[model samples]
Target chain A: MARKRPEPVQIVKQRRDAALNGLVHGVPYVQFLGIEFDRRGDELTAVMPFDEKLIGNPMLPALHGGAIAGFLETTAVIGLAWSNLWEEIESGRFDTDELALGHLPRLPKTIDFSVDYLRSGLPRDSYARARVNRSGRRYASVHVEAWQDQRGKLFAQATGHFLMPASKDD
Target chain B: MNPEKLKMAEQFISAVPHCKTLNMKLTNIGDGTAEMSLPYDLRIVGDPETGVVHGGAVSSLMDTCCGAAAMSHPSSPAGTATIDLRIDYMRAATPGQTIVTRAECYHITRSVAFVRAVAMDDDVDRPVATATGAFTVEGK
Candidate 1:
């Protein structure tokens, strides 16, 4: 079924504030975690500010294992969204908008998410980067890594599959 | 099995701020197995259009239950931390249904504990997700 293609500018904003997480602005869980993003070219990184609320083991002051997984998963979503937008712009389906990343016609759904806790996440600023390995009509795959200050030293890593709801263009 | 073991397990889970924030509660515990639950909350929705809880929330539930199970394991007496966790999603959980997870410490060596878990809503026939992981154990 053919659908209405939104204006180029509207495409970037999608339906919400695209500058932040593509679909995470109104999400209470993501908001509570205080996740932010940086998009440059094909690379997308998710940054999580260190907060007392994120601590899992107060004694060790370690970040909760689940929170780390959440961080990685959320980053992967943003990365996939950004990757799709980049492709759309390249193919002229969507215009290049430096101000905003285009919106996803439909939110991506998680098919599977796995996390490898390499080292204990300490109570400190942590960041994650996700690389989209493949994005097709039916599915997308991403490999994500979270690290403390040093990029080489990772706290955790994850691989996830997202169900990309097919669009009219597909 | 002992009261002291139960207390230890509960205390360890309660100390986690993320667990408190998510409101995951321990429902039951045996020698090397545990059950946990998180009631449906809109705050954790991944797809606002569908109101389905995010897979991350399910992952959190499994990770916590696994940790609790590791704590109760007779071998991991000192305490435990996650080493690795892998979850495969079967489907998105139904909206407004509490997600429950059950985890078991299937095996334990001197330094590590192996765990597996399943998450589901009310339907016992259809599981929402399944997980397997290993945890590091310390000496008491």
Candidate 2:
């Protein structure tokens, strides 16, 4: 009798999910904002559910600009980390089980973040995605766009440069 | 800042849900300038290893401060919204010290207002972050 191994895709997905779960949960601020991620392959979509506490202008009844900026920054960080974790997992350098057991990796530090507000953020659930412009050993640049209700219309966007965590060998 | 503007600024911050959530307080308001403070809170901590506040939190503080400054500007129309904001992180904020941000609406055109701000913890000499922002100045 031979034991059937899980498919390659399933194994990859499980590892990816584990990595994302750990990365997202590692940051206390991420948890504080109640941000969540939805992953497809290597891409990620960050979701911030609407809450009354997130409103910035009660008169206009809009989401706070600061809240939107924070969400965009969080998305960029998670996206960058996921890309690196995917590679590390494939190379067998990352231990998903240990991560699941509570060991977390150090997060990258933000050198700068710039946000452009295109429209007022509506008082509803918001979504964001990050695109990595550059990823190197020491530095990374990521761009993020946020929208609500409609994907074609963006309410806010940001570009952030981060100081990547030093690799263990270095 | 006049008494009317001062009262308006206070009421403005109080109406903001995010401000109340973070316990941000307006310390001072001058002509086209405002100072705000954010108390050290464990929930806003970013790095568990260092217990430092997140850059996002700092950015939030700066953004709100900038907006407040813009609103208080004499040239500012009825209201304002952030157009763009760029923040450069200089250092990590101390764990227990309150973060203070001071913003100035340096320039105002027919349609936009420009602002610059700095955030600091206990060490006022070395800033934690600096920000430059543009805000909408509608209905000149």
Candidate 3:
């Protein structure tokens, strides 16, 4: 008789809630950017509510660019963490609870990021989504799209590159 | 157009509460270029260990310069959102020196504007960081 194949593990479904909590509480800059996580699963979504403190131009009455960048970067990192990439990479040796609670992992530092300004992001109510492009080990890319209140408006888009550490080192 | 730009400048300065806290003031604006200065303040000190401006503050200043450049465009009335900004830090800004940012708009199309800027102390040749950015135009 042929050996029975093991059941496929549902990685994302198992880890979703813990990951979202880590993101909300671990990152200090996330709160500073005033970005709130609304949903997390395969793709993570965040909302950037308008605040005068985050404005770059009071003249334009718009959200500041740095604040937007911070929002996108944070969203990308949280999405990856939620996907259980860190846990999978560190599998078996450590407790899942320890990994989730002890220290939230840092995103591999960004090597480069390119953003295309598509439309004005205004009126304080805006949303963005980040998706990770994973090919193999040691390299990952994140693409983000931000939308203005008018459903049709594509306010901004960004592609960021991060260099992952070697698996054995992790 | 010139008057509108100046009016925008005044409004931009007055609206930013943190800029006021940091003593950042808009000094000049014209011809798709703008200048702003942040006076030395104890609050700006980045590291209690080093007494240099924090990387976060430097990044904010660079972002502001690029955004202001985008806002000064002739067709920009509604405003612009930063799509992306990249900054290369060269050195720590010297203590007790006002950091000045000079930013210029390179091009603008229907949706996006490209900008380049340099932040320096009194000496223009030695810059603290150079930055490039893209901003999206908001609808009027």
Which candidate has the highest lDDT of all? Answer: 2
Q: Which sequence of candidate numbers ranks them by DockQ, best first?
A: 2, 1, 3
Q: What overall lDDT, based on C-alpha atoms, would model 1 receive against the true structure? A: 0.81
Q: Write the per-residue lDDT of candidate 2 for residues A1-170, one digit (tens) a residue.
A: 88966468877777778888988887888887889999877779999999898898898899888888889999998888888777797666789888877667877789999999999998889999999999999999999999999999999999999999998889
Question: Residue-wise lDDT of candidate 3 within A40-124, one digit each (tens)?
Answer: 3355678878776766556556665555666666666566555545455334333447546536554444555555656545657
Better of 2 and 3 by TM-score: 2
Between candidates 2 and 3, the one scoring higher on DockQ is 2
Best by DockQ: 2
Tens-place lDDT digits, model 1, residues A74-104: 8888778766666565455553243334333
Off by over 4 Å in 3: A1-15, A56-60, A84-102, A148-152, A165-170, B1-11, B17-60, B69-102, B106-114, B118-130, B134-140
Candidate 2 residue-wise lDDT, B27-78, digit = tens: 8888889999999998898887789998888888999999999888888876
RMSD of each: 5.2, 2.6, 6.4
Q: Rank the candidates by TM-score, best first.
A: 2, 1, 3
Per-residue lDDT tens digits for candidate 1, residues B15-70, read 78888878888888887899999999877877666788887788888998998888
Candidate 1 C-alpha error for residue B77, in Å: 1.9
Pairwise DockQ winner, candidates 1 and 3: 1
- For candidate 3, the clash count comes to 1
**Clashing residue pairs, backbone N/CA/C < 3 A, model 3:** A120-B138
